[model samples]
Target: MVRTPQPGTHSSTDHDPDTPQYEAGAGGWGSLRGVARIFAEARSSPEALRILAGQNKPKGMMCTSCAWAKPAKPHTFEFCENGAKATLWELDQRRADAEFWQSHTLSELRRLHDHDLEKAGRLTDPLRYDPESDRYLPVSWDEAYDEIGRELRALDPTEAVFYSCGHAGLEAAFLFALFARAMGHQNLPQSSNMCHETTSVNLLKYLGSPVGTCTLEDFDHCDAIFFFGQNTGSSSPRFLHVLKDVVDRGGRIVTFNPLRERGLVEFVDPQNLSQMATGRSTPISEEYYQVRPGGDVAVMAGLMKCVLAAEDAGPGTVLDHDFIATETTGYAEAEAAVRAMDWADIEHHSGLTREMIEQAGRIYLSSNRVIGIYGMGLTQHVNGWLNLGMLCNLLLMRGNVGKLGAGVSPVRGHSNVQGQRTVGVGEKSAHMPADKLRELFGIEPPTDDGLNAVHACEALLEGRMKALVTLGGNLVRALPDRTRMEAAWPRLRLTVNIATKPNRSHLVPGQVAYLLPCLGRTDRDVQETGAQAVSMEDSLSNIYGSIGPAKPPGDNVRSEVAIVAGIAKATLPRNPNLRWDDWTADYGRIRDLIAEMFPDDFADFNARMFQPGGFYRGNSARDRVWKTESGRAEFTTPTTLTALGETPDGQDVMTLITLRSNDQFNTTIYGFSDRLRGLEGDRDILLINRDEMSRLGLDEGQPVSLVCAIDDGHERRVDDLKVTPYDIPAGCVGGYYPELNPLVPLGYHERNSQTPAYRGTPVRVVP
Candidate 1:
């Protein structure tokens, strides 16, 4: 959750150009040093430290936000910039109780910006808004749960939706799924559907797996890496250090991206003493290729053709000829298509030269083992599934799958975002078979197909969805079509949010709205059994236990697990098969159930997760042990060469890509400034190309409204956007999502994954 403080309640500065670079008596940089001091003081303060240490299940447990705790070793800096943001955000000293909500009406709170609303701080109790009084009144835990149960019981289960964000713990998610199933509803919308659903959906189809095959530590063992649209330095700094080691050891990196971000070219590793002290930066990419917005298929096909040619020539080549023939299918036809294409045409469409393409192939050919890394940049395209398949083809051609250092790695955002889906938090349960969820849970779960994120928004707009229970997410703001959502939010019968801090979602409340606050990841989860530990799955499908340090907000406030358990108990009192025994008492039982559900992977979840470092779920895809019917990995061929789109005549079409700033994560707005882009204190600025700006007769800072060019005839427009001309690519413009979400129609999504096409939406930028 975003924790933007209110005016004067917390310390912050305007975009002052004349601020000092360094503060007197401080040992480091200006605002950073000041922030460091405050963080230290917060750690040392008696009450704060008591809340952090005593409330901790295992007293003195380290924070879960970052790698700050000393692991029996000494370190210079205690936290990273983003880690500090997470720590401060969780440990903020503000409180929003019944009285606070009593004074602020829902309509009045709507007038407040997202930043100011978060300033009200952690919710101290569960609240239900009274439309007559125009304020949210405090409700007891029993009453709150009972009211939600009543609503669920009253409605046709299919009309209600249970939406969740990535931050929810595994136990909470499991319990939510159970409750939803008990009620016979399947409208589970999660954060993963927006981000990595393409990778998950396609990988499951191609490799019979939904996760990355390679681990983070495998970057050290790679000889070459093909980074498909991932900005390691800016997006995930830890990847930067790994890339540095790869570069230092004469490893080659070939980047395939439209925008040539500086972070990819040269990044100064703060972990390196010599580099940081001398301000020397390491070069990450040996060669870079800027692929066209929707031309990833051609770029990958071209690379595959090179490997195929080498294999046909002789035995000594990058690809193992026997393995290609025996293991892979469709190589002949794929090669024929690749060979049929002209180099000049490939270069023309991809916006990359043949020389660069050959250089990338050479990098792959020279390396004994390779790892392919990608992010949303690769998965947000119209042909995202085909792009994923293309990457899989490249890996399969060289027998990269199941190798020690060579595999596919997709860097995921939103901590525990992957976990939510792993534990049956999807529209359809992962634990469910064809008929029902009866085999696993002993009761028939919903057989009705569930609504994903996109479907949920459309359902709300069409007034098909009556009730919404957001476990944790800024749904309206995080989703597209914000303007339509603003109007649609009031149509719901009940809107319940189980959140940590205030965001734009809370502003759009229903007639009988409730804000059920819960504990953060860094806070202790206490229950009758004792200090409880919540489990989470990492990006690499590794499940681990997170024992928070700080105390939960108040006595009235509860852990997410407790809230779900309470709701379940209220809703399922008559069911004999149901068990709420360990629901709120402990989280270990939930882990046991998860282990039961996935015996092959998590055989002993309780023992394995208790280790200092987490354990990994053995990825069969890494070993080429496909879980498909054939028991072998299948080669998928693309039906279409490129993504087909209808561009209106004289519209001057371009791909509108949505992005997150270096300072933010998901939809959580931590800071207004994007320091890397050289924009300070401005979230409203769009990064446009200078050359394109000149050709279009536009200035550097021109405010423009963007309208999406959809073939569906749905009107979507985001007006009053500030455009800043920069080093972006021609026929491409970038803007922050959720903010510019008003321009994207909810139905404008990828074909297979159904994930919103935020990256490659066809739109025209007018002056």
Candidate 2:
């Protein structure tokens, strides 16, 4: 698939900036330099080194950098560069003590970039934002909890909101979810509401589960793998090993993305000595299609159409009939829809010729073992739900669900976000079915669905939510429309955040703000039960033990579990039967309760965790045991790809997609350097196709401003961005998120999943 481009543009402003240039090849020396950068910034503290060495070990802390699970026997040094950076950032020697906060005014802190604030070091004590002084001061844990409890109890329960960060252990997530429910509030928002939430809500609707059905071991047997929107090299460094092994086994890898991620083109497995020693990188994607930003549906649908056409030309040529007859439904209708789909529209919207999709179809028809893997790129769109549904339909056609090496895989981002969902981090009903929750907790939790990240922001703005309590995460920086979110936050009467380090959220206060410092994943928790270990579920549903080595940050700081428990116990004095103290004393008790609540999934939860790789939460989709509406894997028809939203007369708009840089992880910025992209010093660089840049009369390093082209009431603009020519699609441009998040409107999100559509945003680029 190819689109003709205009001539390359050049102007006097094209003079090269002082930005550090990156080169091809993702690993080898680049990976080593990343580790060196971590050491240089953190001064290579002993605790950081010791803690990092134990990362991803059999009985060590789970790496929070990515949710990708480890093998049964982890290697000696399994930590990736990003994990090292995260460790250095978390285990910083400098402390955000009372003295630091005393010297820095809230106004001064607000002026500092989010990255500088993170590098200032860990929050060493509980801090309360004193509105009168416009500064934060240390507050006793009891006083902070009491003030928060009073506000929570006084407000109408429905007017309070709880935001969860799934990077925390499952125990913390479970306790927070329970605490919110016990307080009679179901409007609990979570990190999953923004990131891979479509995988949870949509997979449940069609496949009967939200988690990936395939195990990591499936990589050994799969013959062909298709990747959509996942750049494993930078996001999940360890996963590059899997891709290389697949290629070595003669397995084909096809990628569908707007730009050619260097990882997908060639990768040097840092773990592989021969490749790293000789500076040899393996070619990954055999056929790469630059599908339009919002055109995943059209591409997949066109492939499905090709499959149906082949089936029509020769019966039993492409599809599995026996599996369809007994194991699935909706085949006849879905087939008819695909047969009638217009190829011209598919090619137009997808920016791919029919030949490209047919080649993918032929690979699918021939391969007996195939796995389709996708990431937020597909789900962070208006059609996120349908995108997943269409992938399910494609997998079901081949009876791939319960097969040896074939199933659906939506690679999640956070370490235990999946487990957080499994342990009931969403609305209370998600924890236990109505009867089960009543039977287990002896209290009926709210039955109604709660607001996601987007809706929760809306509630805060509209004065529908008065109190905000976050388990962790900088929700304001993570959310869209910071100018508006910063304004909306003050509408809330109370705000409480439990975090490992101080972020911009703590500084941007509500009327009463409490920053309750908590232990990091690499910090030890000494409870009444002696030392404790928390469990986390990874991308493949493997629940493993994560034990931290470093001691708690300070004498006053509490474990996330304890902090959450303390607040809940203080607020609910009426519920005498609830044993918050007992749960805090022994986390194993909480596991027992979890097992009791989810008998089939968590049977022998405590005992099975003793095994090397922990246990797998059961998925009906994996076993082909249909819990879906039709008693079979139902087929879903995807909608036609719509053209970019119309602009005003004489307006030239380009589709914009916000992505993460190599130096960043989610909202946290390690530094300005993005070595993977050959960028440094500045993150405001906008990636544009060479032809498109010239058409707009823009040149490399040319200063530009971006404004939302839509006629939305929200006036979003990010200024002083430099344009960089890159190998992206013709009508598309790219910029890093959190920096460009201001351009995204809260209302512009996937309707079904409520996941903010970070791509396909129409924008006017001013030079």
Best by lDDT: 2
**After best superposition, candidate 1 residue 542: deviation in angstroms?**
1.4
Clashes of each: 1, 1
Instruction: Name the regions of candidate 1 deviating beyond 4 angstroms.
Output: 1-79, 312-316, 433-441, 639-646, 649-651
| Candidate 2 C-alpha lDDT tens digits along 345-423 | 7877777778778888888888888899998888887778777877888888877787888899887877778888888
Q: Tens digit of lDDT per residue, candidate 1, span 336-454?
A: 66667776656555565566677678778878789988888878766788888888888888888778789888888766777777777877656444333566556776766889888
Candidate 2 regions off by >4 Å?
Answer: 1-22, 642-651
Q: Which lDDT value does model 2 have at 23?
A: 50
Worst 10 residues of 1 by lDDT: 1-10
Clashing pairs in 1: 402-622
TM for candidate 1 is: 0.90
The candidate that wins on TM-score is 2
